[model samples]
Target: MLQMGIIGYGYWGPNLVRNFNVAAGSQVSMVCDMNKQSLSKAKKAYPQVRFTSDVNELINDPEVNAVAIATPVFTHHELAKKALLAGKSVFVEKPFTHTVEEAEELIELAEKKKLKIMVDHTFLYTGAVRKIKQLIDDNVLGSIYYFDSVRVNLGLFQHDVNVVWDLAPHDIAIMDYLINDKPQAVVATGSGHFDRGLEDIAYLTFYYPNNIIAHINVNWLSPVKVRTTLIGGQKKMLVWNDLEPDEIIKVYDKGVKVTTTEGKYNLLVNYRSGDMWAPRIQATEALRLIAEEFVHYVEEGGKVVNDGAAGLKVVKMLVASSKSLKNKGEMIYL
Candidate 1:
């Protein structure tokens, strides 16, 4: 079994530990957290696993073959780099690194050391996203026209990053995975409510080459939580409601067609509307699949969908969006 060490026990850290502990071909051997209360809770729950306050101890342990980092965004590059250099595979939480440079450096280092790296983009492993990818790949949603997403919630405000950096990553990663098109430029507009200088509400728009466009709206000031995405295509349209208990994805056979006149002076338009269908999706836990995939990569040399390169793509968008936000939505080119 491949031994795993986890850093951080707050928020998302527990889920990582639980999944990795039972994931095939892997075991959680050590957990590190600076918070005493968090460490105490972990110790009580998992007495078999070792807990330490110092991160270096976990990284240097020979028993640990891989390290999973669930820490803050700022600490990801350093911790992951150290783990890779110390001959351990690395699994880091999403938004990968703070910038593209850090992601490129770590990717290069991991390649040189022949160590595997998987970024925790759990949504990519979800049944809803998987089904959506299948539909797009099967040509059901032919020639995607646009991608529109809205992810907003109240009060889990982050201190380090704005709402765009905090919530837009999920939809951005999903867009990157489903749509095989690269974004050429980004335009963002947002405002901060508090004196912390971090935006609580933001709107981002990405321009692609083939007349494809994507828009994302993220907010921390919304009274109600909303996680929804709409993908419009030439053949069909898709609506993904992440909060729905059942039928999270609904495919609508709807689109508008345009035809040129014989004289080329006038255009004819046609709108097609058909029945909507929701495909049955498997009820598998996404984190477990991610954990299993990580283990498979570490042990069997399998392919990882959410690798460093994928994470870097998402990061590139995030960085460009931030730059646009700073410039008051001046359209920063990627």
Candidate 2:
């Protein structure tokens, strides 16, 4: 069994601990957190696991073969780098690192150490996303035309990062997975209502090759929570409503056909609309899947779906988007 050490017991930490503890071939050997209250709560819940206040203790623990980091974005690089250099595999939370340079360095370090680095891109492991990937791979959607998403909610505003950094990572990671084409450029616009100078609401647009395009709208000021994505393709279209309890994904056999008439000036347009079907998606916790994958990567050498390379791609998009946001929606190349 692979012994695991976890850092941070706040927010997403508990979920990671629970999943890794239950995952096959893995066990939570130790947990570290600076907050005494968090440590006390963790100790109470998991009596078998060791708890410590100093991060170095957990990183250097002889029993720990890997370190899972659930701290804020800024701390990811240092923590992961130290864990990797300590001869332990690293699993870090989403938005891998604050910048692309940091992610690149960690990736290089992990490679040199012959260790695995799994990025906690939980959404990519979701059943819905998995099904979508299958459909796309099967050519059921034909050629993708556009990807649009809206993720917004009230409160839960982060002090360390803006709405784009807080919310856009999910969609950006999803886009990077579903669409194979690389983004050529990005443009973003947003504003901050408070004095923090961080944008609470943002709009981001990405241009890809083959005339493909994607747009993401994220906000922390919305009155109601909304999680929706629309993917349009030449053969069919899809709508995913994450808020729905059932039938979250709907695929429509709909498209438009254009033909040129005998005369160059004349044109014919036709709209084809057909049935809409919802495929059943397996109900499984994404974090659990991620934890299992981490174990598999550690025990058996294989490529993980959301590895350091994938995380680096997402971080590059985040960095480019931030630059565009600062430049008043000026387009920035990736």
Candidate 3:
């Protein structure tokens, strides 16, 4: 059995603990947090699990076989490194680390120690995203032309990272997974409205091979929350509205075809619009799937979709976007 040790009991930490504790072949051995009040609250729900204020105590516990870090973005590298050095497999939250160098170091250390490193990119395990991946892989969407996403909400702002770093990682990871092509360059623009130096809103564009392009808009000052993505392809199009309770994915038979004429100036542009359909999505919680996968991979060797290398890929995009954002939308080549 894989004994799971979780650090942090705030916000996302509880979800992690709940999932890992119930996952097959794994159980919550301990939970560590600096806030004693948070620990007290968590302890009530998990009377069988141990709680600690000292993170080192949990890391050094011989009963713990794996560690999950749900702390702040800045603290990820240090905590994850310590966990890896302790000879335990590590599962960390998204935006893996503050920088690419830190992510690389952690990945290398995990590899050397022969430990698994899973990044908690929860969306990848969702039924909606899984269906989308199936469509793309089956060529149901044909050749993808462009990917555009918008994730906006009010409040829930962070002090450590800007809107791009905070929100863009989700869509970037999705786009990276769906689109097999690697990005060639990136450009970003954003501004800060409050006393905090972090940007409240940002726009990023990624140029990929074969004329494929991706754009993401992330904001923390929107009047209404929006979670939507549009993918245009040669044979069809898709719209994903995450807020919709019943139907999250809608695939449409729509596209534009160009016909060349005898003359250079003579050209015909045809638009095709057809039926739309929504595929059924499994209602299982994504975190539960993540927990199960982590335990399975740790006990039996196998490939992990959201491994440390995948997290590093997302971090590379974030770093490039940050550089472009700082340079006033200057394109940065990846």
* lDDT of residue 113 for candidate 3: 96
Pairs in clash, predicted candidate 2: none
Which of the predicted structures, 1 or 3, would earn the higher TM-score when compared with the native?
3
lDDT of 3 by residue, 106-145 (tens): 9999999999999999999999999999999999999999
Runs with alpha carbons beyond 4 Å of true place in candidate 2: 262-265
Q: Which stretches of model 3 miss by more than 4 angstroms?
A: none
Which candidate has the top score in lDDT?
Answer: 2
Clashing pairs in 3: none
For all predicted structures, in order, the TM-scores are 0.98, 0.98, 0.99
Question: What lDDT tens digits, residue by residue, belong to model 2 across residues 94-157?
Answer: 9999999999999999889899999999999999999999989998989999999999999698
- Residue 40 in model 2: shift from native, Å? 1.2
CA shift of 8, model 1, Å: 0.3
What 10-residue stretch in candidate 3 is worst by lDDT? 257-266
Please give me the total number of clashing residue pairs in predicted model 2: 0
